[model samples]
Target chain A: MIIKRTKSHIAEIFCNVLCVFVITVVSVNAQKLNDDFFSPKSRLSFGNYLFLEKDYLRASNEYKEFLKTDNNDTVRFKLSESFLRIGRYEEAANNFKSLFFSTSLTDEARLGLFKSLFFEKNFVRFRQYRLEENYTTEKFSHDIDRLNYISYFFDSEPLPDSSRLFSAFADLNRADIKKFYYMKKNPDTKNPVTAALLSAAIPGLGKIYTGEIGDGITSLITTGLLVFLSANNFRHDHNFRGWLFAGFAALAYGGNIYGSAASAQIYNAGVKFNFDNEVKLFFEKHNYFLPEFDFVNR
Target chain B: MKKLFYKYFLLIEIFVVSSLFPQDRLSIQFDYANKLFQTSQYFDAITEYKRLLFFDEAKKYSYKAYFQIGKCYKAGAKFDEAIKYFSTASINAANENEKLSVYFEIVRTNISRRTTSRALQILDEIEKENTNTFIRDSINYWRGWTYIFADDWKNAADAFSKIKSDHELKKLCEQVEKEKVSVTFTKAISYFLPGAGEVYSGNILSGSITFGWNLLFGYLTINSFAEERIFDGMVIGSLGWLRFYRGNIQSAEESAKQKNIAIANKILKYLQYEYKGAKP
Candidate 1:
């Protein structure tokens, strides 16, 4: 009777211990659930939190952090959108490109990507992408055309139908096409070898072609003065000084030719860039001057 | 009871450890920064000091560190950066003299670097505020040097004369007074000889160029004369040779006067301000 009584007491103690263990485990699991729900695992959740809170800087930071942690194209596309919302098109374009290949958001990303590039003034890349078969962004068609015209500024390579684009853009912008045609006709001004040869024939002819009359006059006068000094030195039998002045005059002459050619090229580039910017500003302000069609059949 | 006590102890221990680790790391950073400062690696030292200023917990030695940074920048001839740190040191200065000295140094550096206008403004303010006579005198002396640097010889002389019997400075003033030349003289000299005045002022290259051109024209004139080309000789000779000859003599006298004045002014600057010995 005593042995049976002891065994029942021990069994009762074991049951109580089991009950306490189960309670502790249940509480721990509940706490873990609360923590997991509060702390998001994916970047999209964090990005939304930042976007909704109107914390653009923090949103940008979170997006960057997300890129580090996960290479999710969807998240990257959203991140590009976030950059666009903040008016950071340069950063947005880079992030959009990060999602360009094999992402479900490729078409949407490409459209955003072109718009971003357009906004960043990267007309050359935008136009190049426009020519690609896979890169169709119907929404930004007018933008693509405008960028194609603007690409003349950024491209160092010779354009195929620059005159046509220049004329088209000039009509749109009310710019003087005569001046553009004048620059196109004068290839000698752009050629350093031709400018140098021309300058050697006459003191300031290269500078005149480069449209730097004041600098041309100054260069001519400076070189002339040095040559005169060299002649005077030779007359005085100062061979060393004569040679030195002659050398200086030669160098100055050469420098003027090279500088004129470079200046001409720089000026031409500037003209194109200015015209491009005018067109870009006009289009951007007028919603790329294209008809907005929101609904798509697909 | 024992398990509960042990659990609370463990919690306290973890909190303590977490707190201590960060503090210890911060102190180590501070020590490292201080070490960099002591080693004459001032550029790196500045970076370390900046980090400590941002992160240090106790915030002790900040003024000392800033003062050291200023000194280092001063040593490196980065006067603008030195001035910045010195101003920071002055703002946090515990000692009045230290603040005054920093202010003085800032003014001195500006004066040395030929920023006379700004230095003069600061000097005026310091003179008004500083009741200390020694500082006041030092400020006045430096003001005199500042005037000298700006080539304001008359004002420099007057400033130096205000100091109680600096014989050497007085002598410099006398020299400037004696050697002063008319502005028209310099113009006249250049007008007469293309570069003769510059030569008189120790510009050998300019003098030689002028002399060479004149000599060439002289030869041309003589050669033309020998060949019975009278018009050519007269034209070249009159147009070039005569002009350069008269120019050379006028430039020589004008430049000599200017050089004497410059020398006198420089002497005054050095004696009154730079020389730390007896005044005379």
Candidate 2:
């Protein structure tokens, strides 16, 4: 069938042929592009994607891969942040330290380094690092000072004056800081020696002073019963039973003194642990006073 | 005519390339997102899927991205966010089949979250909408799983039984039910006999101790009373015998609960790692 083809039909045929050719070319180019989707440049965005997803381990890995080709400050900061997020504090501290120069990220990195050390629960080491000017970006020194004051509460170091210790914190946090400071300086800690003496003089008074009311009452009742049993057996002329009861009474009295001293130490340890936990939780909830990432603005 | 043809052809080619280029890029992005999900990088997978949703101009794979994001959230144990994305997926689904798949995913997420009622409601909705036997059986299967997660073995068995007479899950549910000791029965036995509940709950050592304490103290109290030692009798009876007797009953109840928990956990562990069938 020889069909009559108009000029418009000829134009349409060329349009269809051109579309097919263009689609083929574009698809081939696209396939090539897709094959390199995991290249280093792509890995940077992929790492950021993982970071935002809170996939810290994989995000860090991606960032590390990207770092082999690119020494970007933002990526370095994110890599450190990823390590910090996953609780690899030592690695995080080292990563953050690499950014501790006169760059735009210096103060943040210094702050991040302190935070990393703080999370490691090595307050002593943190304090030592804080004192070194090499690690100190002076702009964030006040932040470090706050962390240092927080460190005193965590350790057995003698606390600085309340005014000096709380100088770094804003007024909003000063009250809580002061509470922790006073708790350290004049800790509601029982004196072990005094506790032992008190328990020796009165069977369970030491436990009561150590804030263990239930234990104090139990100790008193047990000791009183043993002593009474010994006296009763003696009055009744049962010498063997009386001796046995007296022996028990003596052991109970000695144990009460030792236990009271131990109780005082446990009380002090609990106070320290609770305070440290509160401080850590507070800082974590507030994101350590760091600047928010302005990804949208960028 | 040839010049005009070439101009029109050039215009069409540019349009075609521009249109097809972004689609290819988006498809690659989807593949990368799915790779993340496959590698168990769920949190990152969700982010990638959201990126696809952001640039999906024609909404070609928007619902698919939403469904995948829901799955990623569910894998991360973020049930609330999982449900949120799944709801969005169902809303954006292009057809009945896609919506149906999303609905099943929502049911599975609810079971994981132990939101049994919501899962049941969805299953009922599916049941009313379609009469396909396969769909009905699938709903019943998930219902059984929900009951299992809720620790209601009898209900689980009942749900499974509705699937088929000799189904493997039905058998498992029945076996779990048979092996479980009734907590109420143990508590009642302990109330009547001080250490009997502990022995019933398979705690021989504690049962012996509890019994021995009650016996020795009981004997001491009676002997003290017979010897006219009223104060000693009262103390021994009240503090020693009564305390141990009460403790025995309480411990018996606790042991029963622990036993039930252990049984449920054993089955749950098996299901998680070794069971060869559909799972929530």
B159-198 per-residue lDDT for model 2 (tens digits): 8888898888788888888888888898898877778888
| Model 2: lDDT of residue A91 | 94
Indicate the docking level reached by candidate 2. Answer: acceptable
Query: lDDT tens digits, residues B1-280, model 1?
Result: 3444455456545555544454454455556667887787877666556545544446665676677777678767788888888888888778778777777777777866678898899889988888777877777777877886777767777776777666455557667766665555655666655665666577678678777877777788899999997756886788778777676666666666667667765776776788775331
Q: TM-score of model 2 relative to the true fold?
A: 0.72
Q: Work out the TM-score per prediction.
A: 0.43, 0.72
TM-score of chain B of 2: 0.87
Tens digits of per-residue lDDT for model 1, A1-298: 8887677667656555654565566556544533332233533455555566564555566567667756766667767877876889988888877776787766667777777876676776777788886676664555556556544544454654655666545365535434443444343225556666667777777777767788878988999999998999899998887998899999998888788777777766776676666545655675644333232110
Q: Quick one: RMSD of model 2?
A: 6.9
What is the per-residue lDDT of model 2 for residues A203-292, given as tens digits with 9 covering 90 to 100?
A: 899999999989998999999999999999999998887998899999999999999999999998887788678867876786665546
Whole-model lDDT values for every prediction: 0.67, 0.83
DockQ of 1: 0.04
